[model samples]
Target chain A: MSDFTIAQRERENVQVLELKGYLDAHTAPKLEEAFQSLLNAQRYNIIINCRDLSYISSAGLGVFMAYIEDVRKNKGDIKLSNMSAKVYNVFDLLGFPLLYEITKDEQEAFNKFAGSAR
Target chain B: MKDDVELLSTFADQATVAIENSRLIKKSIERERLVQEMTLAQEMQRKLLPQGLPAVRGVDIDAISTPAFEVGGDYYDFVELSETTIGVIVGDVSGKGIPAAFYMSEVKGIFQSLSALYASPRDFMVRANAVLSASIDKHSFVSLLYGILDVRTGRFQIARAGHCPLLHVGRSDSAYLRPDGMGLGLAEDDFFSDTIEEHTLQLAPGDACVFYTDGVTEAHRNSDEFGYERLRAAAGLADGKSAARMKEDILRAVDAFIENESPHDDMTLVVVKWLGLTA
Candidate 1:
């Protein structure tokens, strides 16, 4: 599958991974690479819009789980928005909603980011 | 003059031994390097296989997966969706080494996502087939057995994308369970949806289904493949064991049968036992 694409815009030092397609064993590596590159550059404030994501497997979920702590340690948070029902089911099953700040849309997520930063 | 000749001969013999020793040392170093490369390759291959079954209840599963040479294409894993439904996949990518290993990962991902949306094995194959054909290298394609096992019903809905025959064993006999379909990632117009077939069997107690890549059937002892007949015989005999034990036993038999012979491809095996309600 075409890996979820990542487009970046600097919002005072935040990087977002806009994920699409299926995030399973195959495409997880691409996400992992993107996260690695972001972390290497010390960009921690992360927002992942899973609007177009159709599915996510354990391996794909693992990438976020593995990096979330690092992002938080840098005084940054990882937020998710616009997750399709199928993808949300996977995250919900894994109890990820408990660990991360998930929002319904970009406005709410961006508001949370602004509120947290202050 | 006699003493001088004796000394000369002794020196010449020592020189010959010294030259041989140097050659041996060089050969030993080269051999060690080869072993090192082989081990690295094997490690890479091992990483491709899933470490363990997902923590999903209501499923009895076992696998015997071994990579040929350094890295081969065989892979198997269970993707846990919930306590009752588990998505299982076993496949072999076309080549060996890094390319096969990488593609195997891609296959795993494709199958996982397809599985998330589509419960029907045939539909899953159709979507994954289209995706893989578009993304992977044009020359690479994979033979796969993707299935969803209903733990509550003991029914396995399986779709084959040009894979080896899966066997259903019961009553001291075995039957082939394979979908007539093409491989994934091969053609632009390759119709996985139409070609995919689904077969359902209510796995009664003591009934087992054996899923494997072609490595088992194509295993060579001298020249011939261990083939489907021998595999059926092995499954029939494995009737009494648990799913995990049966998988081990079958792999052991296939391996022993092809003793002193090397398998030309990656070997993967998955055994599911329908342990119906206990008394």
Candidate 2:
């Protein structure tokens, strides 16, 4: 169950998904759905809080890749924060650092998005 | 009167022997039926492997898996995710026989369905781990190597979830890619993944990367284990060969090393080569 809760702030246009548990073949769908809902709602600027994100697989990364193009086309972006080294290593191997904006802390990710909007 | 008593005892003894023989025959038949079911299951498992590697430009892929009994725990799949990218997965379940094979099927379904949609190896593994942990029994776990090969760019992004080292054979010798991790499905949070290590080898165009299950390295010869050293040597000898040939070479070498002794466990191998770009 690699699922998380989403809290959106309309004023800042920041959508944050608090991810938890393992992200593998079985649980990837939940994340995919969260991503799609955010996209549908036009909440493009996103931050995925990985403080509780225990593990991630290629399939989980695929979800992010699937949505990146859509978010970018909307002139919005997805930034990840509080990623464990295990999760980060997965991103690094697939060249996620090049495609997406990653930050060390949630505040930094949020701040970056806030600054970009300004 | 003595003759009559002896004759009656002899007849009773003969009758008891006849009944026992009939019971033994029924038991033998039951055993044969069980063997037949197992054989069918093994055949089905074999069919799960790709008939041949997809003809992807700039990439060479081949794999083989042999069960110790009628069924095995190891499974591998090659998914054509896109025109240029190919998804490769090799996994081994905790145990052997039907239980492991069933688990392998579950894992395979996830890889097959999600590979078409997902792009990153790490993300795929994380999701898979959670689901497997939830569904599998407490005793079950898996070690896997799941990656996507960008044939156009000659780059592959691989994630290791407690599998064997993927070996890179170059002009000089073998260098193993040891990623951080343990087997999946053990715990929801327990994980180890590597920082994406990139090995660009345009200079060594014929170099090949080999992925194998522990059964190959842990094969036994009498009391001495076959070990990784022998497996590495065989892989080096198989360098620059086609994916199919490389797979064959490794199996043949293992067979020779053990001198036809049956493998104590399941053995699986996959080979990928950088064939340069297609003209």
Candidate 3:
């Protein structure tokens, strides 16, 4: 019933997820599944592209919280990018900017991953 | 041919009966699970509530938490720090059901234990945040607004952490009191400590303050949110009213606005009104 989707791809050895539509309680589990798969494959250097994401609730934020530790434990990072101001406000409200590396675009996030990689 | 037809009818009837039996069994199992969850949520909510708002001299206080069907983690508690001071908190944790209950209880415990140790509102938050970051999961955090109200002096010092703004209505003007702070468990000590600032309010006679979770403003009907403007207006309308009266007015407004829509999140509110020292 939730109008949400996640597109997963790998570029330059970084796992990138493209989120679309509303990411509320209904859609959080789908995001959780995506993260689970990536973790299973040991894909830690991740980028979440939120250009198409229209809304995100605390449930959606929880998905990110639930996984960040394992990703960092592997010395990998999850960087978010391409968030609209509306989407950014939700993250900012919770002080997520302090814990997550959020960039303006996917390219920027990828570049940071590249920089860290080198 | 007649005998074969009778056999087929009997077979079909048995199959239908078996299917219905299985369906009923599955439904009962699901219902059982839901009932268990609701009970746990209720217990958790009860634990979070104050046994009863104590009769603090010169102050009238009341709070409420209305859980949605799914039962979110909205928490509020009053800690009697001293004879004249009360440590109050209203907070919301992400998620619902058992997970929410666990996180809410953890936050309550952490805050409850620390309330006695720190008299300053800011110090309480800083210490609570440190403990939460270590104990709470990264995906789970609580947005808490903590205040130490000294009833004797009518001094209310408050600090926010990713919670909704506190609506304060005085004799002449009403404003939302929101000091800068992030939710607990989102950041470490240095960043959390840096971003948080404590604010103080001196309550005069006929002053009213409301602390609530997002469920109030976010309460929606047909995709239209209640919003901050409406909330401010609702509270302001009851300016100089008793704390209980203002709480009722706001609840009524929210209810009318939602209009047949069941709330999607837990709605919690705390109302405080100051009256001149009890004669």
Candidate 4:
């Protein structure tokens, strides 16, 4: 009975995606489509804001792994920011900290892009 | 008029029989093709699974994989990294059937090719994730545990990615060791690399570790799942036994639990028992 959704916006040439609700096997494909659309549009720099995400499973996490190579190969990066502790724990437990640029807030994530651009 | 009616009825009956015959032939052909495909899939899956566990000094190793269907995604393999060390892995791909089996083979290829290159479990996972991220299909991922065991010292370096907890039964008690790691094809770059943590455990004589797929825990009877508690208990009870005996105990327990119910998922179990230097 869990629900999941994604919202996207462009900020300073970075595609910011906001995830909400539960991300499990059933809802993972939605996230995959969102990423696929971004790739199709040539939008590579992505920042996922997980402040409202209630939960996530390994299948949901696989979506991010599926596209990271293409995004990076295209000279862009996927960054994460503003994760609730519950959602963050899932990432942290999986060793997400070593493989991602996670910041305290969205502004910091944008700042990272700005800094990288310079 | 009566003769004309009889002639019309005969023609209609003949037409209906011909149509039915054609449909039956088509159906049989389709069924035949499906049977052929399933047979091929089964053969391919068998080849992908590990042929046998390697014999190592002071270590007793045993593994088994049983698919619920003609083809399954569960996999376990041992790669001889060197004369002194061996790499062991157990993994499960999401879903089942031919697609899952095909993906399992792809994952096996990746593991075989990359295990030789990256000695550190963490580094190997990072590289494996990068490759899998690009290659794996949407809505599908693999949960795996990779470890290197040194035969001489009984030291195991392990890394897990969203798989089931690694069960360890020591001299006193049994416990589940869950190190931090994500599944393959889940994330890329820093997200994956930063999230996965490596763990090391030294096995003394009488120590045993179990690596398994979710199928073991998720096995069910009626509406009740066999669950992890039972699996841990089984492993604990079988601690002092040989690796082969432990494997049988676990499978037998699962079979008894399920009773008349058939397995709904592919089950895989790998048991490693350390006998120390003397034995």
Candidate 5:
């Protein structure tokens, strides 16, 4: 069986989530919990760093959809950064780009939020 | 001493019988729980599908879905966009059973709520993708084919998302229609918008369009898949038949192809036949 883990940190009022291992059916709930906790805390400015992430299935993609509206409604946004081409392909394949702001690195994603704030 | 040994042996036999009985009870309880879960899931799955096909002018439409498990991932629906236009959709969620059924219901809700707001198939898909990309589970995805048919003009506009190719049958020949697009919930940015494209077809008299899920092509008998070729052939043979008849014949052919072998996935077929103005 594949494994998955999520670690969190705070930077410049943005909540960053770092994901590792496989994001598939068995491990999707962990990501969901992480998102839920962030929402509960009213921390809506989220940046998911997928640099260490290995794989994702459609269910994994759903985690983002589940919370995006609430986050945006609260005047915060969820952005994604640092995805391997392989992980990125999965997102790209399903038409995620039109609805998300994906950057090449964490700094850029953070910069996007900061730039918008200014 | 012999009497004492006989009494000890009897006691040991009784203890072993009691242990066996407890084990059997535990197994029975576990089996019952699983059956109850499956029954609930099946009921939920049935409710997600459209109760009946709607009546649309200038077109004959029919659909069928069969699940290999107690619950399935396949779904189809029709929404009347207006008095003159109707929207049709067919999709398959990845995986099967309870989880798939849950996602299927979500997709159904998204379609039902959003189809009325967007008139263009491409626009509707783009919006649906936006919503689905945000909410769907991370481990699963849904492949979909959505189209809007103009009843008066016999014009069909379609958009696809990693679903199986649409089969088009004219008066004498049939062909597969491949439109470029990815499945829902796979991407979240511009790549998805850039990759997704739409196609339009003018259906004349005696023309038909078939929308299906991968289960139709991936249906297997041992090592051989039912395959696109076989499906195309079946569609060709179904030429001139009513939408309902064609759907039945194609499913019959698939049943024959598999013979006694059980289906490995859910099978769904939706056919739209253009009868033209004369009809």
Candidate 6:
């Protein structure tokens, strides 16, 4: 069984994906599939709630880089939220904030989507 | 006597079966040739690393790159930039085996050629990222830290491309130096250049400056990560030690943490100690 899992839910227009467990090279394809399904449905306003994310690796970040262009091209943006310090450290070190908006919590990210839509 | 005769009859039958299957012999030969080719590739990859560290005027330097059994890509190189300055770099490509090894060679060529042309660490990184972003796949990237040190003044200018931060251990205090920079190939040229940060520091005598890849902090025992705190403690143990001893200290710390676990990725470390300029 894979240690990583994604729970999908919708709150209005924003598609929230709650990521749990470890995200690494071994489980990156699972994340790729999640992003593919989201893109296929034409649902672009995305909020990735990383409250339960324990670890992340370069490959996991690659999955994000691979999909962000496509997601943005469709006029939908992916915002990240609720990352633990350890998980956030990985993003901070790699300068991920420049490409994706990271929020302190899920509500903050949801509010960002609302703000943009207005 | 009957058992011996039966055994001889079985051997004769096996010999006949072997003789009938020429394809089996040919397959075995192909497998043997493949093994030989893989060994040659491994040797060639090993030879790509620096034969030895080049001696600089007023600093002590040591480095070690240990490839895991599966050949994860970890590379380090040194270039003398001027009469008093030396350029050093450490990089790790994503993924493992043949593809990673090949990408490493590409990175090596790009860095070696570009480092001489651009003296500024920030400019070197921007050019490297521009080349890499236009060429490599979206999912593949290299994390690199390139630094140029002037031995005469003990001044170092460094830029990081999503690699581990530099570790500086003084006589009584030690910390990881964090500079703002993205990994190579992850973003376009203008965005990458705008986002990247470079820092300069003056190395004091008896200070040990360490540059390393993720393999050190990510090394684990079961599910427990070795982490940066442990890495800091390990390198701090070498505050006044030689560069070689400092390298050994960090590697030994990781080894003792992981025990006999076969590594998942290659580990690399390059240590530099400022000895002050000689009259």
Which digits, one per residue and each the tens of the lDDT, describe model 6 over residues B103-136?
8899999988999999899999999998877778
Which digits, one per residue and each the tens of the lDDT, describe model 1 over residues B1-279? 999999999999999999999999999999999888867767866876778766545556788787665567787877876667777788877645667777887877776666788878788878888888787764456777877877777777887776766788775667987666666664454444556677666766667788888678767675456877888877764356778887767787787888856665668888877665532
Better of 3 and 4 by TM-score: 3
User: Compared with the true structure, what per-residue lDDT tens digits does model 4 show for residues B129-187?
Assistant: 89888987755778889889887788999999877878988877888889888777666
The interface RMSD values of the models, given in order, are 13.9, 11.3, 1.3, 3.6, 4.3, 1.3
Model 1, position B162, has a per-residue lDDT of 69
The candidates score, on chain A by TM-score, as follows 0.91, 0.89, 0.98, 0.96, 0.97, 0.97
* Candidate 3 residue spans exceeding 4 A from truth: A10-13, A114-118, B1-23, B188-191, B276-279
Better structure of 1 and 3 per TM-score: 3
lDDT of 4: 0.83
lDDT of each: 0.73, 0.73, 0.85, 0.83, 0.83, 0.86
Q: What clash count goes with each model?
A: 2, 26, 1, 15, 27, 0
Candidate 4's docking class is acceptable
TM-score of each: 0.59, 0.65, 0.86, 0.73, 0.69, 0.86
lDDT of 1 by residue, A26-103 (tens): 677788788889889998888888888776644466677667768888888889999876567545533356557888
Q: Report the C-alpha displacement of residue B130, candidate 3, in angstroms.
A: 4.1
Among all candidates shown, the one with the greatest TM-score: 6
What TM-score does prediction 2 earn?
Answer: 0.65
RMSD of 5: 8.1
Model 3 interface Cα RMSD in Å: 1.3
- CA error at residue B171 for candidate 6, angstroms: 2.1
Which docking category, incorrect, acceptable, medium or high, applies to candidate 3? medium
RMSD of 2: 15.4
lDDT of 3 by residue, B194-253 (tens): 989999998887687889988887787865778778888888743557777788888999
- lDDT (0-100) at residue B89 of candidate 1? 82
> How large a fraction of the reference contact set does each model reproduce?
0.00, 0.00, 0.63, 0.44, 0.32, 0.68
Candidate numbers, best lDDT first, in rank order: 6, 3, 5, 4, 2, 1
Instruction: Give the per-residue lDDT digits (tens) of candidate 5, residues B6-121.
Output: 99999999999999999999999999999999989988888788899888777899998887754778899999999888999998787556888888889999999999999888
Residue-level lDDT tens digits of model 2 in A61-99 = 656766777898999998999998766765664345755
